[model samples]
Target chain A: MSVSELSLDRDPSSRFVPWIVAALSLMCAIALGTAFALASMTADWGRAASDQVTLRVATGDTDIPALVDQVARLEAVSRIEHLPREQVARMLQPWLGDVAQVDTALLPLPALIDVRLKPGADTSELRALIADRSEITLDSADAWLAPLQDLAGLARLVAWVLAAVAVGAIMLVTVFATRSALVNQRQTVDLLRLIGAADGYIAKRFQRHGLRLALFGGIAGTVPGLIVIFFATAAARLQGAALLNGLTPSLAGWLAIAALPLIVALVATFTARVTVLKLLRASW
Target chain B: MQQQGTDGTGEPLVAMRNVGLRYGTGPEVLRDLDLELAEGSFHFLTGRSGAGKSSLLSLLHLSRRPSRGLMRVFGHDMQDMPAREVPVLRRRIGVVFQDFRLLDHLSAQENVALPLKVANSMDSDRIDEIVQELIEWVGLSQQAQARPPTLSGGEKQRVAIARAVISSPRLLLADEPTGNVDQEMGERLMRLFVKLNSLGTTIVIATHDLSLPGRYGYPLLHLEDGRLSNESGGAA
Candidate 1:
C-alpha cells in the first residue's frame, strides 16, 4: 500500500509534535509582537523628541516675551511657547507634591519655554543665542530621552532575538519528533520498501505529515497569541497610557504573525524530508 | 501478446557469481553460490528450514546485498547500483515472505493492491476492480475488507500471494507461499502461479513440500547446508 495509508498519523510520537510546535509558535508570535510594538513606540518617541527642545529660564531678571520673540525669530525655530509660572508648578506636582502649590514664594522656580524646531534644524544657532544669557539653559528633548530610548532599543533587540530563538527551537523539536516517528514507524517503512516504494514516495508521506502537524499547531498557537495581544492592547488603550500606545501591533506586524503558520510548516516539511531521506539511506 | 521476461538484452533475469551472505560477523548463511535464472524460466528451490532459502529470496528481493560476490538483476550490477535505483529494480521483482508480512492496518484488498499502488501503474478504479477479482479468485471475497490481524492464517497467505502477483512482476519469489493453506487451496494457488508463468513471468517457489517439484515438472534447485545442488528428480 502507499505509505500515505500507513496510519502514521496515529503514531504515539506524532500525537505530541503538534502540541510542542503549538507551544513554540505561541512563544514566537508573542515575542515578534513585542518586538514590533517596541519598534513602533520607539519610532513615535524618537520623532517627537528629534524635532523639539525645551528652555528653562530662571525667574529673576528674565524678559520671557523678549526671549520668546528672539527664539521664534531664529530661522530654524518653527514655534515657541513660554509656560506661565503656575503651569510649571503643575508640571512638577508629581515630584514636589502640594509644596509648590502651598506658596509660590517658598521656592525659586524657572520659567519653562517649549520650542519646536523645523525638520533638519541645526541646534547650534539656538545654543549660541542662549549661551550669553547665563540664566537661560536650552535642553534638547533628544538629550534627556537618549537613555530611555537606548533601553527601549535594547528591549526591542531582545524581543527580536527571542522570536528568532523560538523559530530555532521549533526546528529542533521537529527534528526530534520526526526521528521518534521514524523509530516508531520502522515496520511500516520497511514494509513499504519491501513493496517497492521509492524513498521519495516514503519521504513525501512523512513530509506531508510534518507539514500538516506544523500548520495545525502554528494556527492553534497564533490564535491564542492574537487574543492576548488584542486584550492587552485594549487594556493599554483603556488606561490612556501614552507610552503604552505602542503595544498594539501594526498591519505589517499582524501580517507577519499570520504568516507564521506557513513559515513553520515549510520548515517542518523540509526537515522531515531531509531526515527521512537520510535515515532511509542509512538503512540500506 | 506476452512480453519477454528479459529486458531485450538476452541476459538472464538474475545472475549470481560466488554470492555469499552473512549477518554481522557471523558465519555465512549462503556460501559461494553461482546460479542463473533465464528469461521466463521456472524453478522450485527446495531446502530444509535453515538451508538459507529465505536468505536467498531476500537477496533476490534486494533486501540484502551479497557480502562478497557479483550479483546482477535485470542487467544491472547490484553492488554498483545507486541507492535510488534499488526501488526501480525491486518493482520488477515480487516476493511472498514465509511469515505473510501483510500490513495489519490495511485490509486484505489493500494488501493485495499494494504492488500496483507502489508501482503506480494502474488507476484507483482499475486497481479496485482487479484487486476484487483477485480476491475472488483466491476465495477471499468474504474477507476482502478484513484486516490482516483478523484474518486466518490461510487467508493471510492468500492475500500475500495475491499481492505478489498483482503487479505482474518479471520475477516472482515465494518462500513457502502455500505452507498455511490446505492441499486444495495450495493446488489452486499453484494454478495461479502457473498461469502467470505461462504469461512470461519467471517463478521461484521455495518449499519443503518435495511433491510439488515433481508434480509441477519444474527444475529443482536444492539447498543443503548453505550450498546449492541441481537435483535430477524434477523436469530439467
Candidate 2:
C-alpha cells in the first residue's frame, strides 16, 4: 500500500497499549535490578558490621587507658567512643522493660566501644590488629544482619528469574496476537497474494502493528511498576537514621528500567515478523 | 499452439501449457488446459458451477500452481520462481472474488485503495482521486467510509470490484462479478468492466451468466465438468 494510505489506516494512538506493556516490563526489570543492588549493598554492610562488632568484643578486656592508647596508635581508627555500664543498661531498657530483678545483681554488661574506620581501611588487616591486642576482645558486630542480607540476595535472584519469565511471556503473547490478526485477515492476505504483494510487505504491516501494541502494553505495565518502586524507595528513605542505610537508586539502575520498554517493543516486532513470514510460506 | 518462450520483447501477460490441477492428488479440477492471454485482450469464461471457473482464475492470479504443466507470467516461469516473487506479479493482476471478499475492518474506500497501496505506486492525491472516481463509478461514493459489515450485498460487490480495478492492472479477473447484483446493477458493473477493457486492460470474466457474453459479443470459452466443450456458438 502507499505510505500515505498506510499512515491513514494506522492509528498512532494505538501504540499506547504496547508502550504500557513495555513500561510494565521495565518496572519488572527495575524491581529485579533494585533487588540485585539491595542484595549486594546489604551483603557488604552485613560483613562490615559483623567485623566491627567482633573487634569491639575482642578488645573488651583492654583497660580504658590502654584501649585509648591503642586506638590512638591505629591510623584506620578515626573516632572511638567508650560507653559505661549505665549507658549500656539504658540502651537495653527499651527491650528489657523494667528489669528490677537484674538491677539487684551487677549486670554483666561489657563496656561498649564505638569505632569509626578511615575510608579504604582493609577489614582483614584491622581485624588482625585487634586480634593481637590480647587485653581487648571483639565479638562479631552485625552477625544478626547476615540472614536479612542473605534473604535479600535470594530475593534478588528470584526477581531476575521472574524478569526472564516476563520477557518470555511477552514474546508468546505477541506471537498469539499476530496469528489471530493473520487469521482474521486471511481473505485479505489471500487477495493481496493474488494481486502480487510480496510476503515482506504483508509481514511488515503485521510487524508494525505488533510492535506498536507491545510498546503500549510495556508502557502500561512499566508505569505502575515504577510507581511501586518509587513508593518503596521513598518509604525506605523516610525511615531516616533508623534504616541501616538509605537505599539510593543509581543512574545505571534508572537507565536499565527506561530501556526495558524498547526491548519489549523489539521483541514483539521480531516475533510478529517471524510468525507472519512462517504462516505465509506455509499457506501461500 | 506453439508455446512461446521469452522473445526479449515484453513477455506475454500469461501463458499456460498442459496445465492441470487437483486438490491433494484428488481428481483434477482443471485438466491439461493450454491457454495464452496476450496483453489487454478481453475474454469471457463460461462454465457450469463445478467446472473450475474459480480454479482457473486462481491460477491466473497466482493463488495456486498448476500440478502438471508450465505456467509463465510476464516472462517469468512460475514453477521455479522463489515464493517471494509471487506478490510482485500479483500486483499487476486484479481479481474480483465471487464472494466480494472485502475486509471487515476497512471502509469501502480503504478496501478499494488496498490494491494501489499493495503495489506502493501512488501518492495520496492520485490515490484519493482514483478511489473517488471508482467509488463514484460504482455509485458507492455515498458509502465510501462504510465498512463491509454494514454494506448491502450489492454495495459490497461494488467495493470488491472497485478494489480489483483500482490499481489499473494489466489483467483483471472477475469471477461471477455480477452474481450478487440485480440486473440493473449487473449491467452497470459490466459497463465498467467494458470501459476498463477498452482502456487496454485484459479482462476475464468467469460466470454462468450466458446473457453477458451474448450481450457484449465477447469470445466465450465454455467448460463442462473439468473439460472444455468443443462446440462454439453465440446466443441469439
Candidate 3:
C-alpha cells in the first residue's frame, strides 16, 4: 500500500484507553496525597504536645514554706498555680466515694502547686530540677503520655509505607492494562506496518489510548479517596482529637484532587508510549 | 510474444536474483529464485497450496527481507537501502489478501479510504468522493456504509480491492482475490484488474485458478515446491 493509503487506517476508538489510564492514575495520586496529609497532621499534633513538660507538685504543712522557696529556684517552671488542701480535696471528690469523714485521720492532705515548663526546657533537666526540691514531690505530666506519643509516630510511619505500596500497585495495574490494549490491537498494528505506517504513528495511537484510560480511572478513584479522607477527618474531630490539625489540606488539596486525572493521564501516556515502542522494536 | 514499449533502460521495476528466504535458520521457502516484473506488465503466478506464493508476495510487498541474494525494487538495491527507507519503497505497492483483510470496525467506505488517509494525500472531501466512486465501481454501493462483519464475502473483497487501488499505486498485487466470489463476480473482478492494468499500472496476481491465464492471454509464472518456471513462450 502507498503511504497515503496506509495513513487512513487509524482506529477512532483507540482514544478511549488512554483516557481511562489517565483517570485511574489521577485517583491513585489523590489516595497518596490524602494519606500524606493525614499523617502530617497527626505528626504535628504529637510534636506540639510533646514540646512541654507539666508537673504536679505537693507539699505538707511542715515543708510548706521550704517547698515554696524550692519551687521558686526551679528554672524550668513557666507558670505555677498554688492550691490549698481544701481545693485539692474538692477536685478529688468526683473520684473518691464516701470518704468525707473517714479520710481525715488517715490521709495526709497537703497543699499543691501546679508547674508548667518553659518551651525550650529539656524534660530530663526539669526532672533533675524537681528532684532537688526535696520538700515537695513533683511528678512529670509526660511520664505516662510519652509512650502514647511514640505510638502515634509509629502509626504515621506505617501510613507512609501504605501510601507507597498503593502507588506501586497503581503503576503495576496501569502497565498491565496498557499491555492488554496493545495485544488487542495487534492485528491493527500489523496492518499498519504492512501499509508502511511509521513506528511513531503506531506508538502515538497507543499512548493516547493509555492516557485517556488513566485519566478516567484516576478521576473515578479520587472520589472514593476523598470520601475516605473526609470521614477520617470527621471521625478524628468527633473523638475530641485533632488528627490533621495544622496539615489540613485547604482549597489546594481539593484542586490537587481535581488535577489527579491530568497527572494520571500524563503518566499513562508516557508509559504506553514506551511500552508500544519497545514491543514494536522487538517484533518488527 | 508481442514486444511492448521499451524505456531504453533495461532495469526492471522489480528484480530479484538468487533470492532465498528462511524463517530463523529453517530451510528456505524460496531458494535461489530469479524474477523480474517490468513496468506496466501483467503476470499471473499459479501454484498448488503451500507453494510459497504468499511468501514471494510478502517479499515483493517489503514485509520481509530475503535471507540471501540480491533484491531491488524501483531501481534501489534492497540490501543496501536503510531500514528507514523501506517504507518509501512500499508506498508504491498495493496488496489484496486472500481473506480480504478489511478492518472489521470500519465501514466499507472507510476501509476503502484507508490508503489515501494513511498517505494524507487527499483531503476529506476528495477521499469521500473517491471512496464513493470506487464502491459504486465495485458494485458495493449499497453496502458502503456497512461494516465488515455485516458485509458478505464478495462485499468485503470489493472493499479490500478498493482500498488497495485507492491511491492509484504503481504496482498492484492480489492473492486469491476472487477465491470466495462466484464465477460471475470473479470474472467481473478480473475485468477491473485488466482495466487498471490498461491504465499503466503493473499487476501481479497469485491464484489457484487454472483457466484464468488461458482466458486472459497474460504471461504465466508457475511455481511448484519453491521453484519458478515460465510456461509462457517468453523470457520472465
Candidate 4:
C-alpha cells in the first residue's frame, strides 16, 4: 500500500522535465558522437605515420637516382616507392587544378618518394645523409600530423567539456523540478508527515517520479540525434569519403547513447533523493 | 506537578510537567500545565474559541515541542527523542483537524487508507478490504470512490475519522471534528469516537459539544488562559 495521495494533476502542463532532459540528451549525443569520431580519426592518422617518412626530390634533378640509392643503403630504410610526376601533380589538383597545360619538364612540380622504416630503426642518421643533398628534402608526415592530431585531441576535449556542462544542467533542472513538485504536493507531504510516514518513503516517491520523467525525456531526445548522425555519416560516405567525412561515432559512442537514458535517469533520481532529504530535514 | 496517575499499569500513557509552548518570539499559547493520561482514558478537551484547545492538541500530535519543561508520550521524553524518531512516536497517535484536512486529490477510500499505508501493512488485499469496510462503516460506501472536494461536509468528516483510526492508533485526538456537520450528523460522529474509545483506543476530542462526553460519562478537560482546569468527574 503506497502513501501516494497526491494527484499529478497539480499542473499537468508544468511537466517540463522530459523536454529539458531530452534537449540535454540531444546535445550529449552530438558531443559524444563528435568526440568519438575525432578520436578514432586521430588514432588512424597516428598508426599510419608512426613508422613511415616521405621524401621530396626536385622533379628535374638527375641526382634523384643517386639519392634513392644512398637512401636505400641506410640501415633504417626498408623500402621506398618513387612517385611518378603525374601522381604528385594529381595530389596537388585541389589547390592547382589541371596543371597539365604547363610542360611537365618545366613545371615546378616535385617527385615524391615514400619511405617505410624497419621497426626500431634510427632515422637520425638518414636525416643527416639527406641534409648533405641539396636536391633531396626528408620530411616525416608526423610534422604536420602532430598538429592535426592535436586539433583532433582539442576537439575531443571540447566534447568532454560539453558533456560535463550537460550533466551539470541535468542536475540543475532536476533540482528545480523537484522543488516545484514539493511545493505542488505540500498538502500531501504534510498529510504523510501527520500520518507518521518515514522521510525515506516520501523521498522515494518523488525520486521515482522524477526518474521516470528523465528517462522518458532523455530517450526521446537521444534517438533522433543518433539517427541524424547515422544518416549524415551514410550521406558523407556515399559521396566518396569527402573532406570532413568522419563525423560518425565509433561503436562506443553509440553505446553511450544507448545507455544515456539510464545515466540521466540516475542523475535525476539521485538529485531528487538528495533534495528531498534536505527539505525534509529542514521541515523537521 | 508530576502527578503520576497510571491506569491499571504503573506507567501513564502521557505525562507532562509544567509544559509551555511559544512559537518563535510569540507569547505562549500553552503554559504551566502538568497532566497525565492513563491508558484508555477519554477526555473532552473544551474551551471557548481562542482558549488554546487546538494549541494543546498540537503538542499531543507532536506537531511542535514545548519551549520549556517536559513532555512525554508512551513513557518517552519528547524533547530528548531524536528528530528521526518523531515518526515512530507519531504512529502511536492520530489526529483529526477542524478543517478535516482531507487531501482533495485522493478519493475517500484513499484518504481513509492513509494511516494503514503509513503503518506499512503488508497485505494489500486486506488493506483494500478493510478500507472498503471502514468506508461502509462511516456510511459513505456509495461515496468511497469520491474525492474530498466532491463530498458533503458530513461525508468528509466521516472519512477523516476513518483515516485517524485506521491504524488502530493507541491515541486518537480530534479537534472540532464535528464543527462542520449538522446536529444529527455531529451526534452520529461523536458516537463513532465513543465506539472507538470503547475498543481500548485512548481518545481525546476537543469540541464545544459537551453533551456527548457527559452522556458517555467521559471526563472533561477544560482549558483557560493557556492552562488546564482539570475536571475529572463526567458532566462537570
Candidate 5:
C-alpha cells in the first residue's frame, strides 16, 4: 500500500463516498447544463424579438398602401414586407386545413406585414402613429414574447439554484466522509502524531484519498448525465416541435457539464482538507 | 538521591519547571515535575504502576500541554507554543507508547518505517534501504510483511522501537520499551537505544522493571504521587 493510504485505516464509509459524489455530480451536470441552455436560448430569442415587429392590416375598405407608406416613414422602421395573401393562407394551413381549395374572393384574410427595426428602436412612436387606425394593429414581438422570456429566466434561476444545492450537498458528503475516516483511524492518527507527524502531513493523506475518490465518482456520474442530456436533446429534435428547437445545450453549456467531475473532485478535496485541519487543530 | 539539573549544557533538550497536568476537573496526574534531559543524556523514568511515568513522558512528547508551570521541548515553551508549531516540535521528539500503538493495517516494515515516512526524511530510495536495515536489525526480516495482528507482542515492540528511532530524533521517549520482550530481546533493544544515544540522541525510557536501568547505570528519575521523588546515579 502507498504511504498515504497507510496513514489511516480503511473506513467502511469510504466505499460509499465516491458513489455519493457521483450521484451529486450527475445532478450538478444536468442542472448546470439546463441553466446554460435556457440562458443561451433566451438570449437568442431576446435578440430576435428586439429586432422585429409584426403588423396585421384589416382588408375591409382600408387604404393598405397609404398605411404602409406612413409606417415606413418612421426612423426605426428599417424595412417592411407585406406578406402575400397566399403566404398568409399557407401559415394558417395547420389550423384551417386546405384553404387553397376555397375561393380567393370569399376569403377574409388580413394583410400581414413583417417589420424589421434597427437596434434599440423606440416602439412608442410607431404605436402613436397607428393609434387612430383601428383597422391596423401593431404587435412588437418583444412585447409578445415577454411572458416566455420571463418563464425562461425563472427556469434558468431554478436550474442554477439546483446546481448550487448539489455542490453544497457534495461538500457536506465530503465533510461527513472525512469525519468518519478520522474517527475510524483515530488510533493511527494518534500514533502518527506521537511519532512527530505534522498535522498538514496527516490531513494531506485524507485529502488525497478524498480527491481520488471524488474524481472517480465524478467521471462515473458525469458520463451518464451527459448521455441523458444527449438522448433528451435527440428525442426532442426527433419530435420536430417548434417549442423544443432551442432546448439543446449551447457550446459553453456542454463545456460546463463536461467539467463537472473535476469541479466535484476539487470541491471534495478542499472540504476534506479543511475538515481534517480543523478537527486536528481543535484537538490540540 | 534527590537531584535537579541539566547535563551541564546550555538550554537542555527538555526542561520542566513545576509542571502539572490534569484531565478535565479531576485531580492532577502529574505535578511539580522539575527536571531536564540535556543533549545526549540517557535516563530512566521509574515509578509505581499509577505513579504518572507515562503522563510525565506525555508532557515531554508534546502530547499534552502542562496544566500549570513551564515546560519546554526543543527550546519552544510548551505553555505558549502555537498550534501550528506543535507538529514541527513533535517531529523532533519520537515517542513509543506503552501499548505499542502500531497501526494494525500497516505491515511490520511499514510500522517500523513510520517515523522516516512521517518526517519525510531522506530520499525515497534511501528510505527503503534504511527501513530494511532497521527491520533486519530488529530481527523481523521474515515478519516484515506481517500485519500487527499477526505479530507477537515482542515483535510489535521491536517494530515500535524501530519506528521511534527511524528519524534519528533528537529526543526519544519510550514508555515500557521492553515490557513485552524476553530478557535477551530486551537487552538487544537496549543496545540499539544506547547506540542511538551515543550518536547525540537524548533517551528516556519509562519502565517498572528497575533492573534494566540498574544494569545500564543511567540516571534515574523516580516518581511518587505525581511528584519527582528522586533523581540519582549516571553521568547526568
Candidate 6:
C-alpha cells in the first residue's frame, strides 16, 4: 500500500467518513430545494398579484349596462372583464355543493368583476368613488400578497441558515475525523517526525486521505438528496402544484450542487492540514 | 541569551552548556550538563535505568528542548532557530528508536526508503537503487519485501539501522538500537553503526551495555543520577 493509504487503513474513523459527508449533502440539498421553491412561488404570486384588482358589486338596483360603461371609461382602468358567475360558483362548490339546487337569490353573493389597471395607477381613488355606493367593494390582493411575500422571504432566510449549519457541520466532521486519525496513527506520525519528515509532509498525507473520504461521502450523501428533490418535484408536478418550479434547479444550479462534494472535500483537506501542523508543533 | 557558533567552519557537531531537561512539572532529569562532541566522532552513551540517558539522547535528537541551557546542534543555536527551521535541522540527524518503530504497513525496503523520501534528495528510481543496496548490506535482501509485522526482531533491527543511515545524516543517534535483538544481532547492528562512523558520520548509541565501549574501543559518556561523566576513548 502507498504511504498515504497506510495511515487511513489503520485508522478506525475511516469507516464512518463517507456517512458523515453524505448526511451533510442530504441536508444541504433539502435546504437549497426548499429555498428555491419558496423564491419561485413568491415570484409567481407577485406576478399574478400586480396591476390587477378584484371587485365584488352587490348590483341591487343599478343597471348592469350603465355600470359596465362607467367602469370602462374610468381613467385608470385598462380593461375590464366580468368574472363568470358559474366559475365563482364552482370555486365555492366544495362548501356549497351543487350550486344548481342552491338558492341563487337568497345567497345573493355580489357579482364579481376582474379589473386590469394602468401601470402606476392609484386604486384608492376608484375605491373611494365606488365605496359611496355601499354595494361595491375593491380587493387588490396586496393584503395577502404582502404576507405571502414575507413568508417566501422568511423561507429563503431559513434556507441560508440551514446552509450555514451544513458548512459548520462539514468542518466539524473533518476536524474530529482528522483528530481520530492522528490519535490512532500516533506511532506512525512519531516515526515520521524522527525520520525528519517536515510537518507539511505528514500533514499532507492525512489531508489527502481525509479529503478523499469526505469527497466520497459527500457524493454518497448528495446524490440521494438530489434524487429525493427530483422525485419530490415530480410528485408536486403530478399533483398539479407548479409552485415546486422553484425546487427544480436550473443548469447552473445543478452545476453548483454537483460541486458540493468538492467543497466539502476542500474543507476537509484544509482542516486536516491545520490540525496536523498544530499537533506536530505541540508535540515538539 | 542565544548565539550562533555558526557552521561550515569546522565547528563541533554538538555543544551543550549547562543543559538541563525536565518533563512538564517534573524534577530536573539532566542538570547543569556541559558537553561537546567534535565532528566525525563516535561515542556510546552508557547509563543506568532512569539515569536520563534517553532524555539526553532525546535532546540531541531535537525531540525535546533542554529545559534550560545554551545548546547547539550542527552549529545551529537551538533557541535562535525558528520553529519552521526545526525540521530542516532534524533532517541532518538520524535516530534509531529502541522500539524499532517501523510502520507495519510498509515493507522492509519501503521503511529504509522512508528517510530518503522525507529528505527529497533523489528521484524515486535513484532512491529505490540506494535503498536496495542498503537492504542487501544489512543482510535482509531475502526479506526485503517483508513487512514489519512479519519480520523477526533481528530483521526489524537491521531495517531500522538501514533507515537511520539512509540519508547519510551528519549525526546518528540510536536510543538502544539493539534493545530488542539477540547478542549476535546486537553486535551486528553495532558494527553497522561503527561502519557508518568510520565513514565520518558522528554516532551516539544509548545503551545499558557497559561492556560496549570497551569492546568497540570507542569513547563513553556515562550518565548517573542525571549527571554526565566523559571518559577517554579506547576501553576506559
Task: Specify the highest-lDDT model's number.
Answer: 1
Q: Check candidate 1 and list the clashing pairs.
A: none
DockQ of each: 0.51, 0.40, 0.22, 0.55, 0.57, 0.52
Q: Write the per-residue lDDT of candidate 1 for residues A1-284, one digit (tens) a residue.
A: 34355677888888888888899899888888888777777787777777888999986988889989989999999988988778877877878888544686666999889999998787888999988889988887677678978998898889889889988888887788888988988877887898799999888888998999999999999889878777876787678877676667888988888899999999999999998999999866
| Candidate topping DockQ | 5
Cα error of candidate 3 at position B58, Å: 1.4
Candidate 5 lDDT tens digits, B26-144: 99999887777778888898989898987888788888899999887777788888877787778788787778888777788877777777777667678889989988887899998
Model 2 whole-model lDDT (C-alpha atoms): 0.73
Q: How accurate locally is residue A125 in candidate 2, as Cα lDDT from 0 to 100?
A: 48
Chain B TM-score, all predictions listed: 0.90, 0.89, 0.93, 0.92, 0.90, 0.92
lDDT of each: 0.84, 0.73, 0.70, 0.81, 0.83, 0.80
Runs of candidate 4 exceeding 4 Å displacement: A1-3, A9-13, A56-79, A84-111, A117-137, A232-243, B1-4, B7-9, B210-214, B230-236
Give the per-residue lDDT of model 2 (tens digit) for B7-124. Answer: 3365667887888889896999998776777676677898888998888888888888888899998788988878887787787788888898777777889888887777777787
The TM-score obtained for chain B of candidate 6 when compared with the true chain B: 0.92
How do these models rank on lDDT, best leading?
1, 5, 4, 6, 2, 3
Candidate 6 collision pairs: A22-A221
True contacts kept of each: 0.63, 0.67, 0.27, 0.63, 0.67, 0.63
Tell me which residue pairs clash in candidate 5: none
Which lDDT value does model 4 have at A162?
98
Model 6 segments more than 4 A misplaced: A1-5, A51-138, A241-251, B1-8, B230-236
lDDT of 2 by residue, A93-201 (tens): 7778866545823666656676666656644545676666665565554556668677777877877777887888788777777777777677667766776677888
| DockQ, prediction 4 | 0.55
The model with the greater TM-score, 4 or 6, is: 4
Docking quality category of candidate 1 according to DockQ thresholds: medium
Model 5 per-residue lDDT tens digits across residues A123-231: 7878898888898888776665889989988998999999999999999999998999998888778878877788898899998888998999999999999998888
DockQ of 6: 0.52
